[model samples]
Target: MSKTILVVDDSSSFRQVVSMALKGAGYDVVEAGDGKDALGKLDGRKINLIVSDVNMPVMDGISFVTAAKQLAAYKFTPVIMLTTESGDDMKAKGKAAGVKAWVVKPFQPPILLDAVAKLILP
Candidate 1:
């Protein structure tokens, strides 16, 4: 079966871009508008990976990851932070929240795809 990836971002356009790329690469995608929405999406549906944006309304990425990690079903699921913020402090916070990879914004699809591939072993 194809792996499922949850993508959390405030931008609908960004989510669409990511969804298309993941779909093209033979993966299923679930999209959310923010951390709160993303949290609601963690419904024991076999999510293999997560790609999140740090800045969002309702709930931020780090807070969402931290909350998600506390859940029994998703504790060890790998997360990748795809955001415009690249500060050391922010990255540190994301690491604490169990983010496995960080990709800066305005990123190429291939670079994000590479990171996703490495984390999601076939």
Candidate 2:
């Protein structure tokens, strides 16, 4: 089965960019504007991985990762934070929330693809 990835970000352009990258690499992609929307989208979908943004309108990536880990179906889903923020404190917070990795924004698509492939398929 193809790996299913949930791309969560408030920026439509960023989401589109990430989705295109993932799809190009042979992964199925879904999109959500925020954590709340992402949770709603996850109801019956099989999400293998998550690429999220830290700052958003409804809910941020850290909250999304923490909430996702609580559900049995998503307990082990790998979530990577793709954001502009690269502070140590933000990274620490993401780590505490069970985010698998943090990628600074303006990131290379290949790097993000590699991380997703390693985490979801390894």
Candidate 3:
């Protein structure tokens, strides 16, 4: 079966671009506007990975990763932070929150895809 990846970002355009790339690579994509929305989309569904943006309104990516790690269903699911913030502090926070990989914005689809391939659970 194809893996399912949740793409969480406030920008509709960003979500669209990520979705297109994941779908093209033969993976299923689920989209959410922010951390809260991403949590709502979980609903017992099988998600192999999550790609998120750090800065958002409702809930930020680090906070989302922290919350997601607490959930029994998703504790083991890997997260990739895709955002503009590349600060050491922010990366450290994400690492503490259980994020598996970090990808900066203006990213090439292929590069993100490679990370997804490496992190997505079987």
Candidate 4:
């Protein structure tokens, strides 16, 4: 079965771009508008990975990841932070919240795919 990836971002266009890349790589993609919405998508489904944006209207990425890690069903799931925030402080917070990888915004699909490959186990 194809691995399922949950992609969370407020921007619809960004999610579409990421979904297109992930789908092209043979992965099933699930999209959410924000962290709260992404949390809803984590309803005991087999989510192999998560790609989230930091600056979102509802529940930011770090808070979302921290909350997600508390769930028994998703405690160990890997997370990748895809955002425009490149500050060390933000990255540090993400790492603390269990983000496995950090990809700055305006990223190429190939680069994002490479990060996904490293975090998303086969």
Candidate 5:
């Protein structure tokens, strides 16, 4: 079965782009406007991976990751932070939150797909 990836970003266009890439790569895509919305969408669903934006209105990616890790259903689900931030402090926070990978914005689809393939739960 194809893996399901939850993509969380405030920008609708970014979500569209990521969703298109994941779908093209034979992965199912679930989109959310922000971290809160992403958490809402994760009700017992088996999400193989998560790709999130760090700077958002509702809940930032790091905060979301911390919250997600506390949940039994998502404790082990890998997260990829897709954002414009590339600072060491932010990356460290993401790592502490259990994020598995980091992808900067304006990214190439092929590269993002490669990261997904490498990190998505089997």
Candidate 6:
């Protein structure tokens, strides 16, 4: 089966772009507008990975990752933070929150895809 990914971000355009990129690479893609919305959509669904962005309203990416990892079903699932913030503090927090990877914004699909492939397939 194809890998299922949940993408959480506030930007409609960013979500569309990331979804298209993942879909084009043959992975199943699901989108959420924010952390709260993403949590609501996780009911009994099988998700192999997550790509999230920081600084969203109604719960940010760090909180989302923390909450996601608390769920018994998603304890070890890979969550990657894709955001514009590149500070050490943010990255450190994401790491502590059980996020497996981090990608800075204005990114190329190929680069992001590479991380996805490695984390999901490796």
Assess every candidate by TM-score: 0.98, 0.96, 0.98, 0.98, 0.98, 0.97
Model 4, range 1-122, lDDT digits (tens) per residue? 89999999999999999999999999999999999999999999899999999999979999999999999989989999999999999999999999999999999989999989988877
Give the per-residue lDDT of model 2 (tens digit) for 19-72: 999999989999999999999988967889989999998888899889988998
By summed lDDT, the worst window of 10 consecutive residues in model 6 runs over 113-122
Candidate 6 structure quality by residue, lDDT tens digits, 1-122:
89999999999999999999999999999899999999997886889899999999999999999998889888888988899999999999999999888899999999999999988843
lDDT, each prediction = 0.95, 0.91, 0.94, 0.94, 0.93, 0.92
What C-alpha lDDT, on a 0 to 100 scale, does residue 4 get in candidate 4? 95
Point out where model 4 deviates above 4 Å.
none
Model 3 — which ten-residue stretch has the worst lDDT? 61-70
Model 1 per-residue lDDT tens digits across residues 1-122: 99999999999999999999999999999999999999999998899999999999999999999999999999989999999999999999999889999999988999999999999845
For candidate 2, give the lDDT of residue 53.
Answer: 96
TM-score of 4: 0.98
Q: Which ten residues in a row have the lowest lDDT in candidate 2?
A: 113-122
1 or 6: which has the higher lDDT? Answer: 1
Q: lDDT of candidate 6 vs native?
A: 0.92
Candidate 3: where is the Cα deviation over 4 Å? none
Deviation of model 1 at 116, angstroms: 0.5
Off by over 4 Å in 1: none
lDDT of 4 at 5: 97
